[model samples]
Target: MKRRTFLGSVAAAGVGAAVAPGLLAPAVAQAATYKKRVTGADLDTNSRWQVAGTDLGIPYVLENGSIGYLFGDTFNSPWPEQQNNDWRSPVMLRSAVHPGEAGGIVFDSAAKVAGNGRAPEIMHNGHNGIGIDNLWEVTVIPNDGISFPETGRQLVSYMSIEHWNPGPRYSLWKSRYAGLAYTDNGNDFVRTNLKWFNDADNADPFQMWTMQRDGDWVYVFSVRSGRQDGPMMLRRVPWEQLFDPAAYQGWGWNGSNWGWGRPCSPILNGRFGEPSVRRLGDGTWVMAYLNCATGNIVTRRANTPDSAWNNEKIQVTFAQEPSLYGGFIHPWSGAGANELHLMVSKWTHGPAGNSTAYHVSQYVGSV
Candidate 1:
């Protein structure tokens, strides 16, 4: 099992013991009301046409009103194997099922992969396998992606990893830098020239990102790669200047007042992994992620993206599911309803590869 998974099992013994004393106050109420598996082996979504098993089910609304899920490290093989896993680091899956509908979110097919498709990767990651160099990038993993409102242009943020080292948690992957890629037709993506952040700065907070749109501005939440012992940062840019790297301004405090500017500061301090932030219909902002300290998936709400995240931290998943991560909020959730559905990924590491439980799951929470 992975280090995080092992910690999760240990945390399951007692959530209170896993978490630091006084790190968080008691939750006012439980956020997770219902839970079920959405996609994986033996589920309805597993097949040759779409995802059999994958991770990072990051969701965003498309221009056509359908929901698009950005997945990482997908496999066409129904059962986990060491080789010939039909590997695709990044792939796109589309679904028309509404969150409020009776059945859970069901993926229809791949975005670009055609008939009898095997869920082909939408983006390029240079060459496959380890010890191979195809210029500066060896393997690029998609973190989070979103579609523009009017233009419908797709933008995804990714990390360029130099290599993956075996044994240990923090040293698992050595990332060179993080950058952005855009696609107008949804099939071909062009990597931008600007580097969002590099690994040279040990404390850079933009290594992982999750983006959401609010009116004329788009809000981005970021954390480090290891997803532990780091602070979450906030940034926003105008919709018109979406592709302009310099247009983004970070939220920071100077021991006096909080404002938006360069060199963003931490909005919340904790162990975070794969954060998901979305604006509710009533303008309330909800953020969800795997809290490594407590070994539980949690959600916190704030009035604004730059506001203090002092609200009650609601636990969305039980302490037992330690291998779970990637809490991507459904776009259509909480628009005019009281329930919010989140797409969460769960996987157990195996010597052959990933176990059959490796797939995306759903958790319904009260808004």
Candidate 2:
């Protein structure tokens, strides 16, 4: 899990980072043209998901056919004061709502929180000196989670942040490391030993990731810790070797050819934040993210996950909607069709007193 260890694994896999790229060209191409639209209003509000205000509404299919979402920095009450009452990060919510009825997604939800009706902070935030290493963690932000049909279990990736600096360097959230946590009951989770450390630069590529399982392998598309800028990279591990960091392989250009098992390389380049990728029911792969360059939620499609990612991007939001990030693909939206439904978040920060627009909206997009 350490950087050297990961590099060693890459070397042990028979691919060196110093290898020349003369065999093939990179997998980037001109963007394809696509379009989108807002299908409904915000999908989550203060009254729903025990989440008065939260972000990162990434959802994945559960074994029981329900949808499970991972939310970040939550405030269950009013703003400012909302931080005082039952605020927790990385909360999980379960919903039985069908993808077709995503506009009403909040109606069929319940958090892990019991009688209090608040969603439980499924992972430790390291506030009480209790974390994977017993150190007080600055924060815990959920990246993305996936449920494996082979094991009927789920694995979630998260960042154990160190601190967040104020403006001028707003986006640099110094992360302790990025680790994996697994759950069997969907409610309780246990952290695994697997982690990718953030060294001097605090820029680890696996910090933010979205995963999808195809055949025996789970493809991981990732970026660095800071959301401002970084190229998205790709890696894969056998479903059975999910926890074995050494078993993972990267897809990259060997200079003359685009192939698998090369040193990890960029498939898509941009000022990307949290991203979501999933294969549509029609067999197309779609990647959605907050484009910091344009300040909009955009998406791109490809025939295969490893194909040249240069497809026309579809803008998923409008100019009127600002201060928005997070474009999580709705699991049920691709069940039997390519109807794209996304869970988008909006958060505008100012001086402490203003009412910040912090909630998740459901949007419908197309290729």
Per-model TM-score versus the true fold: 0.85, 0.81
Q: Any runs in candidate 1 off by more than 4 Å, and if so which?
A: 1-34, 48-50, 78-81, 127-138, 164-172, 200-202, 318-320, 335-338, 349-356
| Model 1, residue 48: C-alpha shift (Å) | 4.4
lDDT, model 1: 0.68
Cα RMSD to the true fold for all candidates: 4.3, 7.9
How many times do residue backbones clash in model 1?
Answer: 0
**Candidate 2 lDDT for residue 206:** 73
Model 1 compared with the native: what TM-score? 0.85
List, residue by residue over 8-60, the lDDT tens digit for candidate 2. Answer: 11111111122232312222322221222221123344444456766677888
- Candidate 1: Cα lDDT at 195: 70
Q: In model 2, what is the error at residue 340, expressed in angstroms?
A: 1.3
